[model samples]
Target: MFINFIWLNVFLMLCAWLWVSYNKRAGLVDVIWAFGIALNVILASLIFETAPLMVRVFLAVASGIWFLRLAWHLLRRYCHETEEDTRYANMRRAMGKYQHLGFLAFFLFQAGLIVLFSYPMLALLNIPMEQWGSSTIIYLVVAAIIMLVAFWGESLADEQLYRFKQNPENKAKTMDQGLWRYSRHPNYFFEWLHWFAYPIIGLAAGVYSLWIYPILMFLFLYYVTGIPFSEQQALQHRGDNYKDYQRRTSIFIPWQPKE
Candidate 1:
């Protein structure tokens, strides 16, 4: 099953490479990455065919909604924008003559990450319900609540940012209202929070190692792809305004802004 999943990701990476090569818009890979993981989870559940029907159904529904929403959000922005996203554009400039190769490597790296993060889902699907204890009910309740809150929070943050950007008056200004008042990347924080549900669910199923998914997610968001590049871009665009926002706002955690 794992081997087949790896091959699926390889195929996805190849397709993303080809598409980026043709479109020269490597940012679309984000949408592809979301759908790729959604597809992987659905496929894994079907191929395993041993997890409790309810568990598989819940996982599919929850993850499917999350990924589809994310894909649609990214696609809408991608269609509206005339240029590549700043992050990918910067990467292209940095890669210079080897931009294609660099992006292909990046696409493959995302593919690997998608598979690695799906470990919790894989673990959950393989655990038999017979192994679950009474305490599993508490974990399920907690996981469901966390997932709902994370999804809603992320959606709100995105909407707020979108609306803020849409206003011409807000140009060159920092968004320090709403959730952004608390965390510079409230959307990212909630996105990371969403992963907590998976590990908790996996724990309920007796798969403790599944905790690695959320931990790795935190590292990637906090250190790798999420905050650092975003801050750099913000600093480039907003300059002192963004710097002031950074000084006053939490970087990742939601907290009362310092006066």
Candidate 2:
């Protein structure tokens, strides 16, 4: 079943790559990833009989809502976009003659990530029902709180930035109000925080391997795709203003901004 899931993701992403290659809207990669991961997690819960029905139901509801919200947010932004996103546009330009092949590889990389992240969910859903204990409740409560905070934090940061950008006067200006005042990338921070929920729950189920998700997410956000590229783009457009904001704001965590 896992092998089938992987093949299906690969095939779906291949189709997505074809569409993106024609439309030149590479941001659709994010929308597809969000929805695909949600579907994968929910489907795993439904088919995996090792976990209790209630636990499976909870996992389905929580993960479905979280990823669906993100997918919709990305889709809405995609609809309003007048051109390809700058990141992808730059990447394509860099690729020059090999743009098509490069994008195909990038899309397939997203497919691989979908499979990798889904492993934790699969592990959680496979926990035997009889293993539920007093500690499980404690872990679930903590995990639920983390999920709520992460959801609201990311949503608020995205909405705040969206509103700030909607103003014509704010073009090329850095956002320093609301959550953005505390962290240069509050959205990315909360996104990394969201992964911690799984590790917390995994403790109750003796699934220590789940801890890797949060660590992997942190690395991805801090050093790889999240802050580095975003800050570089900001610096390119906003110049010294973004650098000043970076000086004052925390890179990954919410904190009091510097004077």
Candidate 3:
């Protein structure tokens, strides 16, 4: 399973490389990154064929919805924007002559991340339904509730931000409305919540190590790729407005804004 996972990412990364080489838009890698995880879920279910049919189907549907929405949002942004995202553009400028190599490295790094995020799904799908026992019902209920809430929260956050951006009056202003008021990164908060659903489901299947999935996801979002970069970009673009938002709002977990 590990070998197949590596090979699948390698192929996906190669495709991303070719696409970026032709279009010179390295930002498309973000879209590819989402789809890669969706594909991983489907492939893992098919290749393993050990987990309960219902479990596999539910996972595929849940993850598919999440990734597809994310991918579509990113794809539209990529299509409409004339220039690369500032994040990748900055990386390109920093790399100078080694920009292409840097992008390749970035793509590969994201591919690894896809595999890492898929661990809980892989673990859950390997456990057979017969072994789930009575706790299975509890697990499924908890997982389903968490996943639904998290997905809905994320969608709402994205929608609120999108609508805010669409308004001319909101330009250069900090978003302190709706979910954004409670947390500076409500979207990331809910995204991290989504990972917990898997481990809860895995727990019912007697998979102990699945806790690592949410832990890794939290670390990645909090300390690595998610909040740090987003806040940096916000600070750069929105300046004092964003700083004020940061002063009053929670960074990851949603809470009432500070007084």
* Each prediction's TM-score versus the true structure: 0.93, 0.95, 0.93
lDDT of 2: 0.88
lDDT of each: 0.85, 0.88, 0.84
Better of 2 and 3 by TM-score: 2
Write one digit per residue (lDDT tens) for candidate 2, span 108-129.
9999988987788877887788
**Per-residue lDDT of model 1, residues 86-165, tens digit only:** 88888999999998888888988988987877777877888876876667768777888998999999999999998898
Segments in model 1 whose C-alpha atoms lie over 4 Å from true places: none
Model 2 clash pairs?
A: none
Taking all chains together, the TM-score of candidate 1 against the true structure is 0.93
Best by lDDT: 2
> Lowest summed-lDDT stretch of 10 residues in model 1?
128-137
At residue 180, give the lDDT of candidate 1: 96
> In candidate 3, which residue ranges exceed 4 Å CA deviation?
128-130
Candidate 1 lDDT for residue 148? 95
Kindly provide the TM-score of model 2 when superposed on the true structure, using C-alpha atoms.
0.95
